[model samples]
Every structure is written in C-alpha cells, then in structure tokens.
Target: MLLTLIYLIASVTFIVGLKMLSNPATARNGNLIAAGGMTIAILGTIFLYEEDGQKLGNYGWIFGGIAVGTLIGFLAAKKVKMTAMPEMVSLFNGMGGACAMLISIVEFDHLFNKDSGVNFEWTAYPPLSALTSDSFFISALPMGQLLIILLGLIIGTVSFTGSMIAWGKLNGKVKDFSFKNQQVLNILMLVLIVAAASYLLWYCNQVGVKINVLTGMDNTNLPTESFFTNVKIIFYGLFVLSILYGVFFVLPIGGADMPVVISLLNSFTGVAAACGGFLYDNKVMLTGGILVGAAGTLLTILMCKAMNRSLANVLIGSFGGNKATGGGGAGKDQGTYKEISITDTAVVMAYANKVFIVPGYGLAVAQAQHVCHELEKLLESKGVEVKYAIHPVAGRMPGHMNVLLAEADVPYEKLLEMEHANEEFSTTDVVLVLGANDVVNPAAKTDPSSPIYGMPILDVELAKNVIVNKRSMKPGYAGIENDLFFQPKTSMLFGDAKKVLQDLVGEIKNL
Candidate 1:
C-alpha cells in the first residue's frame, strides 16, 4: 500500500509536469518536479517493494548500475554543445528504447524457460486451466500476457534501432540510403512483421505445451518436443526481423524530416515502456509512459504541420538534401547581392523604430545565442523595439531555437512565432537574419521548382531593410539558392554568427 501511494504521487507529478512543460517560463521547474517524483518512486520501489513476500535484493548491482548511468549521462550532457543537441536527444531516447526491449526479453525468458523442468499441471496460470482437449492452447502462459510481451519486444526493438540511426544521421555519421522502390520495400517489411506476429499468436493457441510426457518409453501420446522447439524458434525469428525493419525504417528519411522522425520514434519508445508497465502492473510506469507517448505523438503531428507536409508524405517522400536542384536558386539570374558594413548596420538598427532578429542553425553552430541576446538588450536600451522572429522549423528540432535563446535568458514574450512575426515584418524597420537560410527564403513562395516551394517561410523580406549574416553564399539543406539574398532590399553581412553578433553589440554600444 505504501508503494502504491508512492506510485500515485509519481503519476500525479508526471501529469502536472507535462502540463507545465507547455509553457516556457515554467518548463525548468516542471522538469525538476517530475525528476523529484521519479527519484521518490525509485527509492520506494527499492526499499518498500515485496513481490510474493520476497524482498528485493542485489543492492550492489542495482545501485552500481545507477551510479554508472548517472555519471555517464551527466558527463555527456555537460560536454554536449547546443548545436549537437538533436543528436544527443536521439542517443538518450535510444537508450530508453533499449531498456524497454531488454525488459520484454527478460520477462519472456523468465516465463517460458524450457529447461526449468517444472511440469505444468494446470496450476501455473489460471487462464490456461480453461483449455480442454479441444481448447488447443500452448504453454502455461496466458494469451493476454504473451501479447503484451510481443508488443513490447517489437516496438522497443524498432524504436531502439530507428533512434540510433536517427542519431547517426543527425551527427553526420550516416548518410541517407534508399533505392528504387524503397517505399514499396518498406511496406512489404511492415506486412511481414504483422504476418509473423499473427502466425505466432495463432500457433500458440492451436497446441498445448507437453504435459507429463517424456520420450523414455510409452510416450506415444506425448506432444512432440520438435513442435514446441519450433514455437521458440519463431519467437526469436520475430525479434530478428524487428531489428532489420527498424534499421531500414530510418535509413531512407532525410535530415530535414528528422524532427518528425525523432518525435515519432519517441512515441514508439513510450508505448513500448507502457507495455512493460502493463506486464508488471506498475501504475507510475504506466502513467509516465502514457504521458510521454501521447505528448510525442502530438509533437509529431505539430512538427509535420510546421513543415507543411503530412506524416505519410514525410515518411515516404524523403524530401531534403536528396532533391536539391542546386545553384542556390532557380535557373534564372537573381542579380548580385550587396554586402553591408557592421558600422552601417549598427547605425541603421540603432536609429530604426523597430528591429527584428531571426535566428537559425548557424546561430546555434556559432553558439551566438548569448551574444545575440546581449545585442538585443543593447538595442532595447536605446529605445528601439527589438523582437525575435522565430520560424517553426528554424533549428534541427522543434522548440530547439527557443531552448537556445532561453538558455541565454531571453524574455519569452519578446520571441514571436512565425505567424505573428510575419504579421510584424511589414511594420518593422530593420531585419537582422542571423545564420538562417531556407526558413527566410523568398523562393518558397516565388519559385515552384524549388524543393521547399510549398513550405511556409518567415517573410523577413517584407521588412524595410534586411541584413543577412552567413559564412558564405552556400545553399542550406534545401540545396537551392535563396533569392531573398539577391533582393534589392537585402544586404549580405558576411561573418561568423558569433563574431558578427559580438561586433554588432560593440558597434551598437558605441553608437
């Protein structure tokens, strides 16, 4: 009862924390509350849990594993740069998937160990007792329990392998891999997985496990050992197939669609964990899994919407670095771009009625969020209204740019979403684009031939003056030239994002 109370508290905390996570101001506190609840739950389970009146043992192995994992996680997080956050998230999520997968495997082993020499006399699982001669069910394991185990194993393996692939892709360790009719092949794999699982379930229900029948002598009516061994083989085969399917699942997906893929994989992991909870009847684990699964699914939908694509389109279209019609723009001439001086930019922003700052992956790569915030503060001190224009898909992951800016202590109210920022661009005086590309491209609206044509973009071009900071005129992930750079109103400010923001801060202060 005490352990149940602890789980209840933990479950409530999960719900409250998830609700608080929706708002930026409360997100940090929300994380802490959830973590505290989890810690309490773990402690209660370790000390108060008694399964069948058998107290938990192996404290050394349990705490030692915890210590090692905690140390590794702490070190990895501390050393990870903001730019590599997407990959890090994938790696950690993969670990969760792995844990769920192992749980399913271990539980299945414990229940179905063939060498245990324990004869089943209709006493193991009450659910199996109802089976008559014609009932034709195999093993002392209940069908319901077996289903949960299979579900967890399949989903967990898929999430684990898929997330690892995603992590590799995000870190540039793996390249997109696809072939002719790749989508068709993926569909076939899905069908096979379903077929195999169905066959296993049917086979188990069709025959009962051998009872009191040994092959020494007079075993004519005994169930053949070979038949039972085949059942075990089928289960192992299903596990292997799941691993292959997972690898292929994420291989064809392009980098731009990684945000949605990551979210989807996260949902898979959650559902798998929930299966484990159901298997063990753990309330806290179940609640946490449900929350994570639901949240990830919703986030996946939002990510797809932000990209202006359907979930199916994202999975099969493989739209990104692969479909690049290069040269940074359409075949037409866009004219030459003019470069702007830092001093001139500083003067324009300082005297301007309003200025809009747009951040992108380059800003993250340069670790310029802090300096960028500094620049914003300096501009505000001069009575210039400064606002940040945030595109939904600005960084590698959803809410990534928000997190980066938040780390620098930027005000949440000053950061505007794409829709609101677009509405304000027409009234803004100077637009400073920091290391952003595809999100600000005018071709998304003007050129149908471009890969990102139908995608929504921030209308930074609508502002009176546009200053774009980039290391070079290199195309972004879209692989097409951005015509926004060639616009008469646009001026290129070539430099590293951090250096440019630092210089801008100094120049603005001097003015």
Candidate 2:
C-alpha cells in the first residue's frame, strides 16, 4: 500500500510536469518537479518492492552505477554548448533506449533460463474422453507475456540503433547511406521479423504441450533436450534480426529530416519502456512511458506537418542528399547581391516604425542571442517596434531558437511563429534577417522544383527593406542557394553574427 501511494504521487507529478511544459515560463520548474517524482518512485522500488518474500540485494553495485551515471550526465549537460544541444539530446535519448533494451534483454534471459529463480511452468488439465481417450491437455505458452517481450525487444532495439544514427548525423559524424532497392529490402526485412516472432511463439506452444503430455506418460515418449536448445536458438535469431532491421530502418534517411526522426525514435523508446512496465506491473513506470510516447508521437506529427512532408516520405525518400537548382527566379546568378554598411543598416532600422528579426541556425552557431537582444532594445528605444520571427524547425531542433532567445530574456510575446510572422511582414517597414536562409527564402512558395518547395516560410520579402547578416554566400543546410539573397530590396551585411549585431547596436545608439 505504501508503494502504491508512492507510485500514485509519481504519476500525478509526471502529468502536472508535462502540462507545465506547454509554456516556457514554467518549464524549468516542471522539469525539476518531474525529476523529484521519479526519484521518489525509484527509492520506493529499491527499498519497498519485493517478490516471493525476497527484497532486492547488491546495494553497492546498484548505487555505484547510479552515482557514475548521474555524474556523467551532470557534466555533459553542464559543458555542452547550446549549438550542439541537439546532438546532446540525441545522445541522452539513445541512453534511455539502451536502458529499456537492456531491461527487456535481462527479463527475457530470466524467463528462458528458468534457473534464474522465476517460475514459468505450465499447468496440465485432464483430456476430454471424446478427443483422446488417454491423453493429457496442457496450456499453451503464456501469449501475453511473450507478446510483451517481443514488443519490448523490437521497439527498444530500434530506438537504440536509430537514435545513435541520429546522434551521428547531427554531430556530422555520419552521412546518409543508400543503395538500390533499399526500401524494398527494408520491407522484406520487416516481414521476416514478424514471421520469425510468430514461429518462435508457435514453437513455445508446441514445447509446452509436449512437456505437459510427457509429465503424464512413460519416459519412452519424452522429448529430447535438443528441442529446448533449438528454442533458445530461435529466440537469439529473432533478436539479431530485429537489431539489423533497426539499422536498416534509419540508414537511408537524410540529415534534413533528423528532427522528426529523433521524435519518432523517442516514441519508440517510450513504448518499449511501457512494455517493461507491463512486465513488472509498475504503475509509475507505465504512466511515465505512456506520457512520453503520446507526447513524442504528437511532436513528430507536428514536425512532419511543418515540413509539408508525409512521415512515409521522410522515412523512405532521399530528399536532402543533393541541392536543387533552377526554377523560382533562381536561374543562374544574373547579378551580384547588394551590400549595406553597418551604419546605413542601423539607420534604416532606427528610422523604421516597425522591424522584424528572423533568426536561424547561424545565430546559434555565432552565440549572438544576447547581443541580438541588445540590438532589439536599442531599436525599441528609438521608437522602433521590434519583434522576432521564429520558424518551427529553425536551428537544428524544434524550439531551439526560442530557448536561445529566452536565455537572453526576450519577451515571449515578441517571438512570433512562421504563420503569424508572415502576416505581419507586409505591414512591417524593415526585416533584419540574422544569419537565416532557408526559412526566410521566398523560393519555398514560388519554386516547385526546390527540395524545400512545399515547406512554409516566413514572408520576409514582403517587408519594404530587408537586411541579411551572414558570414558568406554559402548555401544553407539543405545545400540550396537562397534566391532571396539576390533580390533588389535585400541588402547583405557580411560579418559574424555576434560582431555584426554588436556593431549594429553601436550604430543604432549613435544615431
């Protein structure tokens, strides 16, 4: 009863924490509250949970592993730069997947060995005289337990391998790998996985029947020990195949859709964890896993919508491998782009009645969020209405730009999403794009041939004057040149984002 109370408290806290995360203001406190609840659940399980009158032992090893893991996690979170935050998230998520996978593996081993102290014997019933005059009836394999184990093994392994691939891609350590008929191969492998699992379950059912019938018969009809050995081999084969399928599942996807893939893999891990919870009959673990699974699935769907791509296309299509050329007024570089001096750009922003700031991955790379905020304040002091335009998938990960701006104490109201920002662009006098390219590019709407053609973008071109700050004329992460750069109304301000923003702030002050 005490353990149940602890679990209830943990479940309530998890729900409240998830609700609080809907707004940025309470997210930190919400995270802390959730962590505290999890601590309570773990402590309750370690100290209070028991099975067959036996409590947990090996305290030293358990606590020692916990201490080492906590220390490494703390150091990693503290030291990782904001620019590499996506990679860190992927790494941490992979760790969660690994934990769930290991849990499933250990449980399977316990069940298969039987000598590991867990009883899994089947009960026999008397046979009906109509069916067999002198035969014994036996229960089939515990299908519920077998199904849960299979689910945990499949989803957990996929999450672990897929998340590792995502981490590598985000960190620039891995690239998209594809071969002819890859999609077909993936489908075939998936079918084989299902077939193998079904065969294993059937084998288990047959073995159970044989063992039960032999219990009531003479030794002459008993099955050989090699039958059990073959069952173990089938189990091992299923595990190995599932692992290979996971690798193949994620290997063909390009880097551009990594954010969505990460969310999907996160959901997979959550479901896998829920399987573990089911196996152990733990309410707190089940609640936590369901919450994560539901939230991650929703986030993945939202990301897919933002990109204007279907989930199937994201998984199977090679969209970001090569840059698209031509179409949407991007036929060759007919003319060089216009350049603006820092003083002139500052003058335009200061004189404007309203200004819009569009941020992107480069802003994070240059670590200029604070200085950008300083420039906003300076412009506001001159009676310029300043606001920021944030794309949904901006900066490597979802909400990444918002996090950076929040750190600089940017007001929540000033950060506008793509749809709202697009509506305000036409009424605005100046749009200062800070190291942003693809999100603000006009090609998305105008060029059907472009890789990011159907994706929604900020309508920065509608503003009277546009100033773009960039280090060079290089294409964006999609490897496509932005046609917006060559427009007559757009003036390029070439420099590092931090340095450029610092200079612009000084110029605005002098004006």
lDDT of each: 0.85, 0.83
Q: Pick the candidate with the highest lDDT.
A: 1
In model 2, the clashing pairs are: none
Give candidate 2's whole-model lDDT: 0.83
Off by over 4 Å in 2: 114-120, 123-141, 210-224, 321-336, 506-511
Model 1 segments more than 4 A misplaced: 117-140, 209-223, 321-329, 332-335, 341-343, 381-383, 446-454, 503-511
1-511 per-residue lDDT for model 1 (tens digits): 8999999999999898888888777988888899999999999999998888998999999999999999999999999977788999899999999999898888777656647523333325335456564323235436677788899999999999999999999988999888888878878988988888888787666544544323322212333567467767878888888898888899988877888999999999999989988988888888889889999999999988887778988888546424645343556787899999999999999999999999998898899999999999888889999999999999888778988998899998999999999999999999999988989988788776676777899999889999999999997775678888998999999999999989988998887
Q: What are the per-residue Cα lDDT tens digits for candidate 2 across 1-511?
A: 7999999999999999988877778988898899999999999988998888889999999899999999999999999977778888888888888888788778777766677433455544444544553444354445567778888888888788888888998887888788878888989988988998888776666644532233465322323477567767877787787778878888878766788889899888888889988988888889999889999999999998888878987887646433334333455564879999999998899999999999988898899999999999988988899999999988878888998998889999999998899899999999988888888877788778777788899889999999999999987766677888888999999999999999988888887
RMSD of each: 4.3, 3.8
Query: In model 2, which range of ten residues has the least summed lDDT?
Result: 320-329
